[model samples]
Target: MPADKKPNSRTAMQPDDASRILVTAIEVGDIETIVALYEPDAILFSKSGRAMQGAEAIRQDNLGLIALKPTFTIDFITATVSADGQLATNRMKADLAWTDKEGKEKRGSVDTLEVLRRQADGSWRYVIDDPYGSMRANLERR
Candidate 1:
């Protein structure tokens, strides 16, 4: 999808639907579809733990991944909806495969955490996406 083009009208009526749409968009390199899945001020945490916020930043970040022509399989762990039914949290593991610049296939997996909010239109969109959310990083005690 072109950067200047309008995003797709796909709506995530269920939390898991959002995950399905996301993985499909990524696999197909549909930037507009991927961007449309996020809220305007959404935040996305990269594999390196760098944070990219807002639509533009998120768009740019995903563009890099799209360039890799990656494919993914998402295994959903859990999804918890708030009592008010307006917010949800999701945890999943994404197995990724892509070809590097040298044309060698690479494979890896990452744990993801996503926060989704129900829009007034009754659809869900991601507000926070952390690709490495489940990783236990090394930390030093003070």
Candidate 2:
């Protein structure tokens, strides 16, 4: 999947550029632009125990969250990229407060363990996008 697809206008991301893409998607909620950074037929094995592939699946999965946290943003104070800058594993604490489908006001936070992989294009994408370590992170925390 080496993206030798002409230099053109797209900036060649420096390996761990996935963070920028991820952050951008969260901030803007634009699935098309975000998925463009990844392989056309990539599969995401999410930590939520959801396995999704292609643009539509990923888009819908993210859209489902918006009803809860309409505007998602990461507050990563100590997110570090790998030595080669090809991967990044972060421990981020996120907070979201919203009314659920049942009209219940709830505040929640998750300690995340996110993983990113460098694609053949030298740009990084979330191959295993584990934004939340597990439900346990939310359940165990008081």
Candidate 3:
């Protein structure tokens, strides 16, 4: 299924919930559910670190990942909400496994960063999602 161009009602009530829901959706390869986690004009970063804008673009990019049938185990590190409670950031560590084209299983871990906004309905949706944001986090750990 394609992205609906709008965040679905099945959204997060808290910042960490957004990350949890997204990882779960990806694990199950639920494209529709995954797209629903982002805002219509959200920015998503591809595995190659390319920036993709809008829902359709995000959906197309995610299709590539879904094809790999990846599994993720995420441990949320921190969730900080703005003083006004309208914006938040979620930081997490994700261990991922997927089958390569050669039918070999590959595994890796990365830190993920997501920025979410509180919708009019009080639900949280991602405005920016960057799986590769771990580069900076990884460097900091060094």
Candidate 4:
């Protein structure tokens, strides 16, 4: 995609469900809530550079996220849906902090791309999401 190409990819039914789930999944750190917005076999590509497949994978990550951070805020700069209304992607800048095993808290801002898949029920879920958008570059070889 060229800079002047103006990449606007979104569907008519993309915004409502995709925006809500994207915000809730990160803002509240609720995995189950996020999962409810997804298809049972959806795949997740996280910015942390991990590929979590299915509800079970999402559940495990969500549980750890809650326990580790408990609080995190996500801000969306822009988001768009696929033309078919089956996919939506968002650009989020996150502000978060977590306690390490050594009892120290680590915090920072990371650039990421969140990809959501709209289910058959008009709901949205993460199909291949990422916390750090650049992680995909690293995943290419794997």
Best candidate, TM-score: 1
Candidate 1 lDDT score relative to the true structure:
0.81
Which residue pairs clash within candidate 2?
none
Measured by C-alpha RMSD in angstroms, how accurate is candidate 1?
A: 4.2
Candidate 4 local lDDT, 15-122, one digit each (tens): 344544544454555554556655677666655456778888877776766566533465545678789777778776766777788999878665566677766656
RMSD of each: 4.2, 7.6, 4.9, 9.6
lDDT of 2 by residue, 1-142 (tens): 1222222323326433454455445444555555665555565545555668777777776666643544334555345677977776555566656677798887766555556566666655555555556454554464
| lDDT ranking from best candidate downward | 1, 3, 4, 2
User: Which residue runs of candidate 4 sit more than 4 Å off their true CA positions?
Assistant: 1-29, 46-48, 135-142
lDDT, candidates in the order shown: 0.81, 0.55, 0.80, 0.59
**What is candidate 1's CA lDDT for residue 134?**
81
Model 3 misplaced regions, further than 4 Å: 1-9, 136-142
What are the runs in model 1 whose C-alpha is more than 4 Å off? 1-9, 136-142
Candidate 2, residue 64: how far the Cα is off, in Å: 1.0
lDDT score for candidate 2 against the true structure: 0.55
lDDT of 1 by residue, 10-111 (tens): 688888678777776776777888888999999998766778899999999988987887778776557899999999998888888989999999998878
Predictions ranked by TM-score, top down?
Answer: 1, 3, 4, 2
lDDT of 4: 0.59
